[model samples]
Target: MQGILTQITALLGVTVGAALIAKFLRQPIIVAYIFAGIVAGPLFLNLVHGEREIFHIFSQLGVILLLFMIGLSLNFNYLRRIGKVAVAGGLAQVIFTGVIGMGILRAMGFAFMPALYLAVAITFSSTIIITKLLSDKKDTDSLYGRHTVGLMLVQDLVAVLLMVFLTAQGGSMTISSSLIRLALGGLVFIVGVTLLARYILPPILRRIADSKEFLFLFAIAWCFALAYAASRFGFSIEIGAVAAGLALGSSTYQPEISARITPLRDFFLIIFFVILGAEMSLAAASTVFLPSVILSLFILIGNPLILYVVYRLMKFSRRNSLMIGLTAAQVSEFGFVLLFIGRELGYVGESEIASFTMVALATIFVSSYLITHNGKIAGAVQNFLAKFSEENHPQREEKPPVYDAWVIGYHRIGWNIVQVLKEKKRSFAVIDFDPTVIEHLTKEGVPAYFLDVSDVGLLSELPLDRARLVISTIPDIQDQVTLLKHVRLHSAHTVIVANAPEAKFMRTLYEAGADYVMTPHLLGGKWIGHMISDGKASRAAFRKLKKEQQEEIRSGMPVQEL
Candidate 1:
């Protein structure tokens, strides 16, 4: 125990110093943790000692807490909204990556089972790392961020299912029986937890809500309890942690619980990264360096491309697709678990494990940098995409229609605006990437282009010179800025209205020459203030507001974070 304590102390000291340098150098803190591990592990100072198993147990806390917080962020409403997307995106991504990657590995001379296992492992991206980075940027509430989170959740679920089957193959259990048991156990587990979350915890939480200490303790206990309960049902503790958060996600105190637990998550996560780093040595890296580098390149580049294709097919904006896709460029913690399990089952050997370890370290390093600088990277790629698009598609020959007003996006607020425009009998057209919206509008004889806003050459063809007004409802600030500049440059008389998610961005829009900027929360607050201006809201007034909101909601797509 004393030796373990001393080892931990020394590791922490090295980690803190390395993390400070990483921060100072503007690198991701995760990178610093890995560097610290490499220095402290047997390859260097050899400060990582004591029970190795204990370190793994400790490192796993960071993974659990991160998942828990992600679950907390996924409020009930978002969960319902994301069900279809997550299922489709997650399954499609896995199948594509696994099959294609396995083929590539086979071509590279790996045996079938080893190739299949590695391919399976590569399909998972680190949910913990993604949530951490997104949280740091306060982008968890953004549309792409929401999509990425949903995708990661699907990946994690897939990983769990794969592990169960893989274990069954290695043990006495028949595959069919194992799957049957898993299905039943998982279903019961989910339903039971959902019931507890919906019915049991709310009242108890409400009662203890006032005491900060009590609430914090309850959150921790709830997280750990579910984590233990999850293992009994064949689910991973990470899943249980997420379930715990999902239960309380709808609570008013989610923000407080999340905030209080963040510091602990950070610390444990640092330890996790360091331990991952320490597992790699110069000898291990050198032995399988070529294959590791090849696989790492595939993960860093091909994973995002597959996801990019998925999002594009779903009619998301190219920029949005690329941004979210890049978040999947790293191998997940589950990938390591799968590889290690394969080693234990004798499906793989030390050489395979070492290669994958190098791949993990390499992919994590590059992908972290990619995620942190995704905006700039996506923008650069968007330009390349545009160049290819022009070479492939013919230039538009039809003269662009002239409209008095233009709606830049056709979802949520933009949908409402189109309704009002129709009521007023104003000549307006919608420009959006949503094929469904475009198809609907086209069927109604309203001009709507199924187009990406980032394609400048195409947008420039629009008759902005005759536009009386332009309203942009896209969520990306860069896209909004581009439209603002284009409209401002073309016609000074056009009154441009833009939407911002918050007040701070309103100023940026206004500075870019927006005549009126609508921020939903700000306007909602003002409307709310109007309601209570005469004192508490009357029952009649509340009912009227409710009806109006329902009617408004029915006018557009379902409510989403964007």
Candidate 2:
């Protein structure tokens, strides 16, 4: 216990020193953490040698917390809509990468089973690195971010299934029976977790939320309990922890729970990454290094290409597709964990695991840089990549024949404007990327679509020439700029309305040819002032507005009420 405490202190000191250096250099903190690990690990100063087991336990906790948070935020509806794309893309990448990796190994004179295991290790991207980097870039709210998150979830599901398959293969059961049991077990696990999230967990969290200390302890306890249960039931501990967190998501106390647990997650997660770095030393790197380099390049470049193709095929804009493509340019944490487990099962060797880990770390470092400077990178490559969307590419519907005014993003202001347009007998259609929103719009007999406005293909298909006005409620400056530029090119007379969160950026957008920029905050204040001026801020008037909102929602008109 004394030795462990001393080692932890040394580890933290090393980490803090490295973090300070990274901060000074204006680099991501993860680089510092890995460097710290290399410094303190047995290969170097050996400050954290005997305490490796303790760190590993914490590392596992970090993985659980990370997965749990991911599960908590998954949009089930969105998942269903992109289910086919996600599954097909994720599975294809896994199979293709695995096969290619294995083939390369066999061609190099390695045995079949070892080569197969090595390939499986290369098939996943690091979820931890990807998510952390995305968060750092504040891209979590963007379409690309959302889609990337969904893709990772799909990959996670695939990895879990693979784990189950591997487990079953090691057993005496027939293949068919094993498959059936795995399916049933997974179904039961998912349903149980869903039920726990939706019902049983809420009250427990509610009762304990008032106590910070208690909530922290409870979160840890719940994580361990679920992990233990999952392990006993032949499920991965990471899956169990995520399931546990997802189960708690239905609770109103989730935000509080998450807030309380974040620091703990971070601390443990640092240990996890550090431990990962420590485990990087392998004897057979002389043989595996070349193969690892080849596979890493394949993952970093090829995976994004596949995603780009899929998005293009789905009629998405080249810009969004490219941006989203850049997000998947590394193997996931699941890849590392899967490889580790496979190694433990004696299916994969330590050398293969190390090679894959090194590739993951290298690609992740590059991915972080790419994502951080994505805009600059995209701009640099835009002209060269333009050919990808050229003559051979299906032309975008740049003009709609019927609609006089097209509104994108039918939320609060958009819905109100739609009502006014209807009263004025203006022909209009709503276009949104959200399938649920599109479905609700359809139910209201309003022409709507699950199409991203930023997608070049979708833009090419749009009847922008017929539209007298186009109002976009999406507050992305880049998307707004792109839309405005396209509108000017396609229809000189079309009025383009876009949103900006800040007045300064709004002015910039207007100068860039936006007919008007809606600053939601400023507009809200103006509306509130107008209401006060007209004496419409009274209780009765407020009640009337509330009633109208409820009615609109009931009538399948999706509006932001709160």
Candidate 3:
């Protein structure tokens, strides 16, 4: 017992110290955790030698919470809106990668079943890493970010179903019976969450949430209950935790809950990654180093190429397609989970698991480097990759209509401005890359196309000179700067309105040549203040306008009450 406690203390001290150092160095913390793991694992100090099970349990919890947040981010309607390009691109990448990975594994002399498992493992992209990187780079609001995230959401949702199917295959049930059982399990899960969310949790949470301590305890209880329920039903605990988050996400309390739990998630996740590293068998890994490196390179190169090919075929501009493709170069954390489970199922031995882990480490490390140096990489390959583009298609010829205004991002703020533009008889059109938003606009007879403004080639295609006014509702300061620079080069006198969520970003946009910047909260207040000062009885009119606008806002939001 004393030894165990000592190990825990040493492990935390080293990891926390390393994490602080990494933070100061402006590097990814995952690298620090892995390094700390190597220092503390069997290969070195051996502080965390035998207590591997505890960390494993915590890691499972991380997976659950991660999946739950993923579910919350998903909007089923987005699939309907993506054009032939995104859908074709995503499907093509999945199929091509899965097949190629399997072939490579088989050629290297692995049996068919393990090869299949490895292939499926390689098909996943790390949603967490991608989200964190995109958010950090302030690229999350770009057209490529939106399209990439939507495609990832589909992959995750499909992965959940695949997990369900795989779990059943490993059970005692026959395939047909297992399918029936899986359907029943999902139905039960949905019903149970609805009952708990609609009837049981809200009132209790309301009272508990009034006290910070109680709210924290209740959240833990909620997470544990769902996890236990999932285990009892022959499902993964990760699936249950995700359901818990999804239920909470459906509530008005979601943002608050997410905020409160983020620190806890961060703390636990460090231990999880450390444990993952500590379990590695260096001697075993070395034997398979050649195979692992070979497979990792395939993932680093082939995966992104598949995405790029599909995007280009779908008619996306070179820049946007490239950006989206870059996000797929790494194997996901889910690949690690799948590899671990492969061991438990007796499909892979310790050496094979070590090989997969090495691949994870290599690809993740290299992918991070690639994403960080994306500008340099893009520039280097820009000319060579252009040869693959189907740029001569007939659809490129039709000229965009002459408009007085052009709006970027048609989801949140853009939607509201579009309504106003219509009311005022302003000749305006919107630029967006999301399939769903574009589809909705098309259905409403608005001139919308799947556009990626980050793509310099696509920007070159737009008739920006004809539009006297431009409004960019995207939140990325860098992308806004790029667009502003191009627009200035094309037409120096065009009036431009853009948005930023923060003062620093707003200032950056203004310096980049924005005529006016819309900080949503500040602008909303100013608009209401003007309405209140308009005339006698303006307060009453303002109240009515608020109700109508609020209703419209709620209706147009991507999130729906589930």
Candidate 4:
């Protein structure tokens, strides 16, 4: 105990120093910890030496806590909202990338199993990194951000199933029987957790709610207890942790539990990253180094392009689709976990695992900057796309001399703005990328064009600068930034109302010369607060609101069939 504690103390000092340097350099804190581990590792200063087992356990705890938090945050309604896009678009991305990645690995002299495992593993982007970056940017509610989150949820489910298969792999029973036993065990465990959470747990929770200390202890105990139970039933401890959190999700105490657990989770997570960094020592081998670089390049570049094509086929605009794609340009924590499991199962080696570690490190570092500067990156890409559109895209010979008002990316928030324009009997036109939206709007006698709003060359042909007003309901940062700049450049006096999904980018749009910037997430919350303050939270008010919102949902859809 004394020796391990001493090691931890040294590690703490080393980590703090690295974290400070990372902050000073404006780099990711995760990258810092990885480097800190390398510096302090037995391979270097040997600051941490005895019983690596303890650190390994702590790293697993970090993973469990992270997964549990994700389980707690799972929302069925959100999954339902973006279900098709998340499942279909996400699968398409994997299919394309998997095939390409498999070919790359196989050609690089990898065994079939290792190649397949690496291919599948690398297809999943890091939800942890993407979510944290998006949350920090206050963009978790943005259109592209929302799609990215939904896709992460889909990937999470797939990861869980993969873990299930891995868990069954080590059993004495045959694969089919092991799977059957595992499924039955899972079913029983879920039922028991459900019953307890619904009935027995709440009463226990109510008593603990008043004591912060007790609540925190209870949550940890409950989580570990579920984990132990799952392990006894031949399920992985990670799955149990996730199931426990999901069981508690309906409880009112979730917020308190999450708030209490987050700091602890983060601490353990640092240990996880440090251990991963120590493992990076293996990646320095000359044989693996070249292959790692090649795979990292594909993850950073090809992954986004593949996902962008998928989203484009799903009818998302170029700017929004590209923004979403950029969020997924790195390999996932699950990829690391899979490589670790494969090593344990003798399907892979330390060199293979190290190759993936290097890939994760490279892609995460590059993709962090990609996501951070998405607005500028997408803006630059849009410029190239615009030139291509001008050179090749078919254009209407005749164009309207002027539109009284123009609505860009007409859906969601645009629907309400369009309704108001119609009520005022103003001449307006809608621009959307979705052909069905254009068809529906045309059938309704609205002048809607199915075109990319970011196509500056195409937009130049349309007299958008002559419009009295321009409103963009596209809740994507890059889209709003590009549109705002283009409109301001052409006609400084136009009343350009743009949408931002968050306050930070709301300011960005305003600075880019938008006359008015709307952030629906912010505005909607403030509106609700005012309503509640004004005594509008009554049953009658809710009843009226329910009807109006239902009607709005029907009216706001891009197409009735969709």
Candidate 5:
């Protein structure tokens, strides 16, 4: 017991030291954790030697918890909203990358099964890493960020399915027979869970939610119970854990449950990454260095190229395509998990595992910087990439009719403004970079232009000078700056309203010649204050307001403005 405690202490100490160094170097803490693992493993200090099994158990728990949290946050409606590009594009990239990756590995003298496993492993991009980086860069709500997230979610679902398929193959039955049995079992489990979630879980959750402690405990219990059941049925505990969370996902307590599990998840995940690192054999890795480097290059370059072609064919702008493609240039955490499974299944050896691990480490390390500085990278190569775009330039062959109002960005806030404009019978044009948004508006017979306000050339094409009012719902400071500069330069008298999420940016926008800068957070607070001051803050009134908002949503009208 003393020895185990000492190992834990040493592991934590090493992790902290490595994390501090990684932070100083401006690298991801994940890189630090893996380094710590290598240091603690037999390759170095050998701190985890006797307690390796314990650490492995902790790592598996981490993965199970992580999948549960993922299921809790998975919103099917969100996937639907992102539309075909995310779904179709995600699947297309995976299939193409897998095929090409397998071919590359085969040519390099790998057998079929190992190459197949490696290929599938490389096809996924790290959701956790990308989400963290996107949040850090404050691009979580950006068009490109949304698309990237949507694509990752789709990939995640595919990974889960693949994991289940692989688990099925682990049995003595033939491939087809195993698959058939698993499918039938999966169908029964899903149906049973869905029925329970819809009818049984909600009421129980609501009752338990009254006591936070009980709710939290029940969530953990449910997760482990389903996980155990899944393992019994020959599926992985990861799938079962995710299924449990999915069952509870529609409950009112999902957010609270997720919050309660996150700290636990983070704590265990450190162990998981460490175990992953500790398992790597540097000697074995050395044998496959050349092939690993080749695969790494393919992931870092070829994966992005595939996405670029996919996005361009979907009519996305060169800049957006570049950003999205660059974001996907790394293999995912699930890739590591997949490789680990392959090792366990005897489909790959230690050298192959080491090869893929090196590829993941290399691609993740480089892609972090690539995604964070994607704007600069895209700007530098914008000219060169523009040549490959379906639209070489943002072109409106015929001049759009002059309008009373021009709405830049057709998302949440802009959508509300469009409703107001329609009600007032104002002539307007919606400007958005997202092809999906533009297509939707065009289909609705709304005057919409597929133009990014950030592009000075695209801004020039729009008749902003003639519009009496120009409102930009885009919260990006650079894009807003570009719009304000153009409007101020060309139409000094036009009223320019801009949106800024942070109050700190309000003064900047105002100074940049914005007549009014709307801070959504502040606006929401002011609205609540108004309700209180007007004696409309009663519970009944609040419920009535909610009802009205829901009705508006149901009727396809925008609710209150952000």
Candidate 6:
């Protein structure tokens, strides 16, 4: 116990020191944690030599909890909203990366099993890391950011499947029999959980939620219970934990559960990463330095290339394709876990693990900067990369049309604006990239064109100079800036209304020549406040408003759906 306490204290001290330095350097704390592990491992001060097993156990729990939180956020409805690109593009990137990576490893003289494991490792990009970067850059709602998140969720599902398959292979039964049993068991588990979530868990959670202490305790207990059941059924704890979270994913309490679990996950994950660093052999890594560099280069370049081709073929604009592609150019934290599992199973040796670890460190560190400065990076190479597109053309041509107003991005907020415009009987044009939206609007006799507003050349061709008003519902600052600049330059009298997700950007947009900037949060608060302060003062008026909202829902005319 004394030794364990000492180890924990030492680990925390080292982590804090490394984290502070990393923050100062503007580098990811993940890199610092791994580096701390290396400094404290057997190759250095050997601080964790006596408590390696404890660290290992903690790390395993970290993986389980991390995956559980990921599962909690994986909403089916949200996935459906992102459309087919997330699923199709995600799977395609995985297959291409794995197959091509395997070929590369095989050519480098690795045995088939080792090559396969390494290939699988390279195919995943870190959801936690990339999502953090995207969120920090305030681009999570941007076209590429949304798709990147959607793709990562799909990748998470695939990672779970791969983990299950690898676990089955390590079992005593014949590979085929084990796989069959695993599949059946997984199906049964999912069905049972789904039923419980739909019928049993809701009532139970509602009661627990009334007591904050019980709610937290029960959630942890439920996670472990599912994990134990999975172990009994010959599945891994990681899979079971994720399944547990997935069961609660549709629950109203999911966000609270996720919020409570994150700090715990972060605490344990530090141990996991530290152990990972401790286990790596610098000597072995040095021997494979050339190969690791080759693999790292492949991931940094090839992964993006694969996604770029996929996005281009799917008819996404060149800019969207390039940005989304850049987001995938790193190995995921799951890659490390997969390699660790392979080492435990004896499918890969220390050398192979070391090589992959080096690749992870290199790619993750570099990709952070790449994603942070993506705007400049894209601009620098946009012309060169445009060659990959099916056509090196500006956004589609627009026939000259006279309009009093132009709406860019005909979704969500724009939908409501379109209704108002129609009610006023105004001559307006709607520009959106979604073919379905365009086709529907056109069928309804609304003049709609398929165009991305971010394309300056294409946007310039639109007769913004003739319109009295131009409204942009697109929340990305870059796109808003482009529209504001073009409209200000070409049509000084046009009133430009723009939307921003956060208040901080409102001033920036306004300073960039926007006539008015709408911050949704502020507007939402005001709307709710008006209901309470005014509507609630008159019961009849409140009831009338409620009835209208209910009727709208009944008519399937919800603002979001539109």
Better of 1 and 3 by TM-score: 1
**Candidate 4 lDDT tens digits, 1-562:** 9999998888888899999998999987777887888888867878767769999899888877866765565444554677888999877887898999999999999999899889989999987677657755756646787788778767766776677678678656566776687778878987898798789987787666656788889989888898889888866676677678777775555656766787888899889878766655553567788999999999988988898778876777777778888889999878878988887888888777778877887887788889888978988898776653332322122223477999987777777778889999998998875545655587788887654555564465467788889999886778767777888888977899988877878778889888888888789899999999998989999999989878877766554422
Every model's TM-score: 0.69, 0.65, 0.61, 0.62, 0.62, 0.62
- Model 2 residue runs over 4 Å out of place are 106-109, 202-224, 248-251, 332-351, 390-562
Report the Cα lDDT for residue 156, model 3.
64
Give candidates' CA RMSD values in order. 13.2, 11.2, 11.4, 14.9, 12.4, 12.3
lDDT of 2 by residue, 474-533 (tens): 767887777787788878888888888888897778876888888989988999999999
lDDT score for residue 102 of model 6: 96
Per-residue accuracy of model 3 over 28-89 as CA lDDT, tens digit each? 77778877887888888888767677767776666555555544443334334654445566
TM-score of decoy 5: 0.62
Worst 10-residue lDDT window, candidate 2? 391-400
Q: Please provide, for model 6 over 1-562, each residue's C-alpha lDDT reduced to its tens digit, 9 standing for 90 to 100.
A: 9999998899889888998999999887777887888888888878987777878889878777776765575555654667588899989999999999999999999999899999999999987667656755757646677788778867976886676677777776566776677778878877887788789987787566645567678888888888888776666676677678778876655656765676788798888777766766667776899989999999999998899888888777777787888887899878878988998988988878889888987887788777887778888987786564455433332245789999988775887788889989999988875546665687779988655566675565468878999998887898889889888988789999999988989888998889999888899899888878764647797688889878855643435644
- Candidate 1, residues 1-562: lDDT per residue as tens digits? 8888988899999999998999899998888888999999998998877678889888988888888888887777878887898889999999998998898789889998888888898888888778888987767767778889999888878887888788898899988898898889899999999899988996787676656678779999999899988988888888899889899887656656776687888888888888988877456667777888888888888889999888777766777778888988988878778988898887777777778778878888888888888989988878777764332322222244689999988876887888889999999998875545655687777877654566554466468658999999888877888888888988899999998977789889998889999988888899889878967589988888789988876765447624
Off by over 4 Å in 6: 80-87, 106-117, 126-172, 230-236, 315-324, 332-351, 371-384, 390-562
Q: Model 2: number of clashes?
A: 22
Candidate 5 lDDT tens digits, 251-321: 54565676677688889988887776676666667788999999999998999889988988777778888
For model 3 the local lDDT of residue 375 reads 57
* Number of the top lDDT candidate: 1
Ten-residue segment with the worst summed lDDT in candidate 6?
Answer: 390-399
Higher-ranked by TM-score: 4 or 5: 5
Model 6, residue 405: what's the lDDT? 98
User: Model 6: clashing residue pairs?
Assistant: 126-332
**What lDDT does model 4 reach?**
0.78
lDDT of each: 0.82, 0.72, 0.72, 0.78, 0.80, 0.79
